[model samples]
Structures are given as C-alpha cells and as structure tokens.
Target: MDANTISHILLPIDFSESSLNAFETGVAIAQKNNASVTIIHVQDNTFEYDHTNLHGNHKIEDNFGDVLNALADAAQLKLGKVPRLIMGEGPITASIVNTANKYSCDLIVMGAHGASGYRELFIGTNTYKVIKYASCPVLIIPTKKKFKQFNNVLFPLKPLPGVLKKYDLIRCMTSNNQETSLEILCLSSKINDDDEQLFEYLLDEFKERTEGVPTKVSSQYSFGNNIAEIILKTAEELRSDLLLLTPSIDISNKQFFIGPYTQRILHHSKTPVLVIKRNN
Candidate 1:
C-alpha cells in the first residue's frame, strides 16, 4: 500500500505470542504511514445458565486492559500517539469486524494461528473469519515470521476469469516500496494457444503498471492440483517478505472454494500474507 493508503489500523488481540507479534507489526506500519490505531479484545465467556454479569465481564476487562495498556505505552513511544482499545462480548469474528467498521479502520493486522497453535488456523477463528467478512484488507503475520520491509513479494495469479483483476490489489500492496520486486506466478491447469497469449499479455501489462518497481512474471503450466504447493515453494525459494493473495478461483469451473488454495497458503506460508477480498 502507499504511505497514505492506510489511515487507521485495527488490531484484534488475544494475548497469544502470535497476537502480540501482530501488535508490534501493526504499530510499525502505523509509524510508517502516520495512521491511527485501534485494539479490540473479544470476551467469549458464556456459561449458558447465566450470561450477563457485570462482575464477570469486569474481571475479564481488567485482564485484557493490563496487557493493552503496556502495549499502548510502548507503541505510543514510537508512534507519538496512543492506540484506542475496544473490548466487548464475543462471537469473536463479528465483534472484530463490527469494531473495525464502527471505528472506520481501513486495515486489519492479525495473527495467522488460532487455538490450534502454530501449524494451523482453526477454520472458525480469527484470520479466516476476519478475512471472509471484513470490509478492508487483512494482513496476516504468520507464526514465527518476523516482519521486515517488503523487498520482494510473491503474487500467485491463476489464469481463471476475473483472476487478473487481483493484480491491481497487488499493485497497491507494493506501492509503498518502490524498490520492491514482484514475482508473479501465473498458474494454469491446461495450456492452450489462447492461454499462452493471455500469459504474454499479462506479463506485459504487469510490467507496464509497475513503472518504478522491479518485477518478474513467470508461467507454471499444467499445474492444477499443486497450485498451493507451487506458490509456497516459490515464496520460500525467493525469500519473499510478503505473499499477496485473493480468494481462490477454480480453473475448471465457475465456482471457488477457500478450503484448498487459500487455506493451504495460510496454514503453511513462511511469508506474511496480505489478503485482499475484492467486492466482485
């Protein structure tokens, strides 16, 4: 994104090491962009018999408030501004999204792992739900991956209908780093004369749009089943700092599923992922 593309950032914290790491990364971005920050904590306490109690909620609020205060103090030292922290009942996903919209947060930075820990994101938790429903883009910091200036970005584009539109989002994601080099992996299941022509045109189009940036566009043909594997491997091989993703588009048909491609990438990517869910 451009320096001003993000004016307000929303962070959802559960106090996991992963979430805390996300906190650090979010502040770093805010410092870079001169953006405002908001922290949200969702309380999921429900004892079916009695759900509403001020005392119980107060205890939980204190617990989250202590950590948030410490975090805000440190971040303020760097940002010269204090971040707003909002706490409410959960239904985690809905709370996070609603808080973001209510505060006019343009970007959400969150951790990839959930209760399952480092290896996987429970489909029902933080990153998945937030990306699925949030109005703005979500940046996911993977477990154990340190945040760095994005010098190289791995953008995997499948040659399905409407997939090329994702390139515009990639452009915005990398606009902040003029020195960033983008490696576009054009994946296709079946090769044809038309597809070959499309690849050539796509390469030219990508290069032209990235005027001051260094970019490389390559084609991986006849690779349908292993698209996710291919993308992860390339990002590793290139030592990419960020992996830009849109929802998966099935090449064989008109429908798409998040289970296969996007899930695999989120589950196993060593690089940070920026998920841009377009309204189309």
Candidate 2:
C-alpha cells in the first residue's frame, strides 16, 4: 500500500527522448514512496581507466555534472527534491549494473527504444544486457508509453514451485484504489494434467490473498506452445499498464532467464515489463 517497499530507485539516462520519457516514471515512483532517486549517465570514454588521465576524467565528470544538475533541477519539479547524480564512465550496460550494485539500489528504471527508429545502446539488445545483469529489479518503460496510474497489472508466471516469493512486490507496485486490480495470467506451454493443477493452485493462492486488500485480483489460465506470444496477446486484450514477470528460473542456471522465452517478451511487449531479479 506504500512505497516503503522501495527505498531507493536508480535511473540510467542518455539524454535521449526515450530516456527522458522514462525520467517521469522513475521520478513518479520516488515521489510516491518518498524514496531517494539517483540519476546516472554512463559515458563510454575509452581512456577513462587511464590513471594518468584521471584529472581529465574528473574534468569530464564536472562538465557532466552541469547537465545532470540541470536535469536534477527539472526533475525537482515533480520529485519535490533534488536527485543525486552519478557520471559513470565505462561500457553502458556494465556501468549501469555496477552503479546499481555499488549503491544498493532497490530498483532500476530505464527506457526501451521501440522496434523501429532506433537510436543507441538503450535500445533492442543493449537494454536487455542491463536487465540480465542487474542485481535488482529492472522496469522497462517504452518510449511511446504514457505514464499513468498503476491500477491494472498483468502478472504471468510458470507452474514451477517457489516462484511466488515476490508476490508482495507485485502488490507494492500497484495502487490501493478500489478499482485497482491485479490480473494473473496462468501460462502453460502444454495441457499437461499436473501443470494444469499447479496453474489453478497458483491462481487461487494469489486470489485469496486479496481478501482485505484495497485491490481486486483475478486470474486466467492459458495453454499454448508459444507462451510468450500468448502472454503478449493477453496483455493487449486486458489493456494492461504493466506486465510483471516472476520466473522460478535463475539467471545462471542451464534454464536461462535471458533465453528466447523471456527475451521475446521483453523485446516485443507493448506494455512496460517489470523483471524481478532472483536475488532481489
């Protein structure tokens, strides 16, 4: 019911329009929870690691601070406080992941460039690069997507056990309004008898937890070979504002989280996707 669930949020921006659009989402989340926000911009300067040129790097960061300060000033209008800024130097994705880990950020909100009309790293593949390596949850907001209330959510999960540990995270991301609701999409790759039972059980378990909460929760079971495609279709039909994924699969396991299944959803989903890190 409160942003206390999120203490600090890390935002990586490139000054691109898409990145600027994501600024609203990151700031909005901070404003909601009274949480602190840190805005980071990574510059892939080749000579950054040269200790001899440390002074030059410092000068560059000082210049970057000027722009970051302007951005912080603008964000203050919505955040009600000046956000801390970090001028990172290194590879785009690595810098982002390392900064989040170093600062102990609870969440990383970044922009996702659309299918066509691409600009740079935060687009198609590079964005996923950061998502796969981040220590915390990564929320991808599309360039054209509008920032609105988090009343409706679409959560998809497998029948695997121990995947519901972050159900509380889902609740915190949504509002407490009466009309606020969580839609659970029970996804199955086939019509196996055991998986079907587990699907129903997962749905009912979450549904029961909404009894006294301000949000209404409902679920639907879906069977298909192409689970990702089915999920995208369901999200469109429900007009979901956010797509939440909590997989039992670990990032390092033979069954990869960045495999084709999750990759398709993150790359193509029209709605924003919140990928909860396993260790988070």
Off by over 4 Å in 2: 1-4, 46-65, 114-122, 248-257
After TM-score superposition, what is the CA distance of residue 183 in candidate 2 from its true location, in Å?
1.4
lDDT of 1: 0.69
lDDT (C-alpha) at residue 114 in model 2: 27
- The window of 10 residues in a row where model 2 has the poorest summed lDDT is 47-56
lDDT scores of the candidates, listed in order: 0.69, 0.72
lDDT tens per residue, model 1, 1-280: 3322677889887765567777788887888777889988776664222212223434434555676777788888888988887877768888988888888787898888643343454422657878877877888987655573556787777545565566564443453545667777777776668877777787777777766655555444445668778888988988888888865432332222354677777777778888765542
Q: Write the per-residue lDDT of candidate 2 for residues 246-276, one digit (tens) a residue.
A: 6642224532257666777877887888887
State in Å the error of residue 52, model 1. Answer: 26
Q: Candidate 1 at 261: error in angstroms?
A: 1.8
